[model samples]
Target chain A: MQYITSLITATAKPPPDNAAVFSRWFVNHSSWGVLMTVDGQGFPFGNVISSSDGGTGIPYFYLSTLYDPTGMNALKNSKSCFTLSETALGTCGQADPQFPKCAKIALSGDVLRELVSVEEDSKEAAFAEAALFANHPQLSGWPKGHNFTVFKLRLKNIFLVNKLAPARYVPIDDYFKAI
Target chain B: MQYITSLITATAKPPPDNAAVFSRWFVNHSSWGVLMTVDGQGFPFGNVISSSDGGTGIPYFYLSTLYDPTGMNALKNSKSCFTLSETALGTCGQADPQFPKCAKIALSGDVLRELVSVEEDSKEAAFAEAALFANHPQLSGWPKGHNFTVFKLRLKNIFLVNKLAPARYVPIDDYFKAI
Candidate 1:
């Protein structure tokens, strides 16, 4: 978990016109975003959390159910949205974050905890863990007592706003294909 | 609407030891964050949006109800949450954002739009508009047909995680006093 002391421009930015490529590039380059989950009261609860896509266009998170409401909320109701802004990447120029040209994406889906003990998905879980630690090295040293586990967003929708026109929903297939 | 192309450290940061003051400082210094709203189907939808407090403790926003789902959701169900991370301020150093010590604050409340036409709250609405435009100059030039308006969080709870301990719920009164 490295704190960004200053904003730095991304090495490369996919053109905004290319939704699939742009979304993938945005997700791969960004290390964190807001993860929203349904709270106990059935209200929306947004938490700033670290994430990694492992370049697969699928977001993975290392979460602690005991200490974080996000993980707890996911266990009860998997419906969630992971949102990222190009503003965080330092590539939006002078565009306001809410400005259409600034670029923002919301991945809507069910958040399910990865079962590392299961032989079938263990490899994917390991990959996700490696990805998380690779981007967020400090995650490796998180407390074991906190009961951290890997969770992944099963993306059902990819909503992106990058141009001055109305926002577009990037096709899920296209998102994966971009990678 | 300023783009943060380079991360710059916040000029000053409040000591994380104090919950009330720290929360106010965090909220005041941050220009943008993820605003979470419940979708029609009861799923959490997180949007990256700009905000301002105008030195006040309460968060104010300029939103386009015509183009943004967040404002629409708020109109239907006022229950919403606005979250900000110290990492965004570039003041958290090397701490992992999720590492509690980096500091994060979540304001949970009903997001009500200010009725500028009403006589009683018109002054407050005017102040909110001025505060927003002061921070985001481009907001004033946004498309008028978008139906943008001032919205505020009638804060009910302030959740802060600043230390390596359990997060604290700062007393609402103390938060206002901190301003």
Candidate 2:
């Protein structure tokens, strides 16, 4: 198989206000994104995690510090990218018949770490913890000594695809706008 | 963070009666079960493809025939695993609000090569091709040589999740039953 690896960059277009295209796609589909990072040996480690916003409209996620070797490696490496896609239903399983199984969106970019603080009294710390908890309700009862860290993807590129149309590449700025 | 590699090895389960769940979770969420192979130099390569039937109603996917560099490296070394998830609407952007944004699944197993064929008179082949083309209408006019090679995944483990539920890891066989 031929491997293609160039960072495609483009400005995000303001999606048509009435365009239910992306919204419809996200609904009747499962949302998954891949995280790419380098290990200590410098080998690329690609893993997937649940993506969500803290109910505040900003994309974030909650992951177990104990179960994420790749995430740890990513934090250590300090350089990582994510790839997310929205595909047609037929492509996944025999899920929905009314929907064509082919539309998708992939977002790939760098990762930045945001360390969680223990002090709930500090406004800054409380805000951060609240944000993290909003996306990860399971973390509400974490035992003491457990460490949690939040990271953000400094998005680099966004790939929007519909088997019905040509694929489009949007740069970071445009991606946020389109979002 | 710990990197755990788990396989979904069990008897095959019957295909889901409603293929909707499978299609929605897998095809629509194509980013969920991406195969991560490494190049000759140990660089990673990822692709999103669906598995074909293994004659048991269970879905399966395969590696490339030519032993692409990454596939070769992955085979020589140990196979790696990844997890997939998505963000809900209104949370990420002005996308689908009614649909749960967070959909996640975890898949693990070795990458293996399997032989597949399109019989000269096989209606299944025609149907599969038509389904593909209908979603990707542009491909309707493309030359056959440009098509991707098809393969099936011999599943070892499969896990799935929705915002309202805890993640469930189904043995390959059980996964079929759940469908």
Candidate 3:
């Protein structure tokens, strides 16, 4: 007797707004993202760190030389990817009720050129500088002993999952628009 | 005239537990991490994804087969690296941050194997299967139709910031112990 098997399928809807979803997802669900970069030899390297200016309303970052050698490598490589996800906690047998799994994201693009210091011409840079400092108080007294550089990500594509039911994807343009 | 250049420096205390710090940083700063992998020619490719997960105490992932071709390539090439930071935001201007950013971790390891089905006799097989199903309810009825796979990352070494950070050389045993 030949038994007929049926196949079931489900499709994920595009997020309401790519950028908005991206920003909200990053802000609401996680506090850190991995930065991936390839050395001159093309070997992949990753690092974990805290998010500076990322939140529901913002999707950008404020990279510093004192903390990121991977970003430094990214500057030199000019091509890299960033990933973020919820943490996974149960598989290893920790009693934490919260399942600490992670969703993966890959941000590939060239790091834009660095911006001048937010301290330069405070009067002229008030709006942008104030906004940055206010949102990220960790940067209050940072400029004095540190060198700052700003690089914008020329996004390529984004992938996401909520570990809920069905996973989803976000296109590059859609991601920017959502934010 | 002697010019006084005041340098404000704060000594960063290694978190009581590196694993806790790593896990916390990843959970709190999800938008900044990068998922990096090497290509067929050994070139790295990165794409940012909106990350979320089941919140398992351990870091588990449900990867989609649809758009993860590059991820497959990287896994095939060698172990991939994930990097993230918070301090880089200060000096890097949405590029990199410093200070608190002094903490960075590199999770290096290979993709051990990808499992799609759970065996009845496997360890935690029931729990693992239930967890998988719960996370992908769309596959509830059509277990056979689900194309999801669970990839195992056999962590090798966790390289922290400064290249010489004591926590940088985290062995897999240490990771397991931390939890």
| Predicted structure with the largest DockQ when compared to the true one | 1
For residues B1-179, could you state the per-residue lDDT of candidate 2 as single tens digits?
11111212223321333222442334333322445544444334454543333222333332333423324555565454444434421123432211233444445555543323534324434433444444343334533433333332345555454434334556666545533
Expressed as tens digits, the lDDT of each residue in B1-179 for candidate 1 is: 12222222235787788788888778888999998889889888888889988777778899889978888888999998999988888888998877778888889988999887886567777877888898899788788898899999989888888988888899999887774
What are the clashing pairs of model 1?
A: A1-A138, A6-B7, A7-B6, A7-B7
Q: What fraction of the true Cα-Cα contacts (under 8 Å, chains A to B) does candidate 2 also have?
A: 0.09
Ten contiguous residues with the weakest lDDT in model 2 chain B: B1-10
Scored against the native two-chain complex, candidate 2 gets a DockQ of 0.12
TM-score to true structure, per model: 0.92, 0.49, 0.53
- Error in Å for residue A123 of model 2: 8.6
For every candidate in turn, the CA RMSD to the true structure comes to 5.9, 11.4, 15.0
Q: Score the docking of each candidate (DockQ).
A: 0.64, 0.12, 0.23
Model 2 collision count: 42
- Work out how many backbone clashes candidate 3 has: 88
Q: At residue B102, what lDDT does model 3 achieve?
A: 50
- Candidate 2 off by > 4 Å: A1-48, A54-58, A79-102, A115-129, B1-32, B37-48, B52-59, B62-143, B152-179
Query: How does model 1 score on DockQ?
Result: 0.64
For every candidate, how close is chain A to the native chain A in TM-score? 0.91, 0.58, 0.57
Using lDDT as the measure, the top candidate is 1
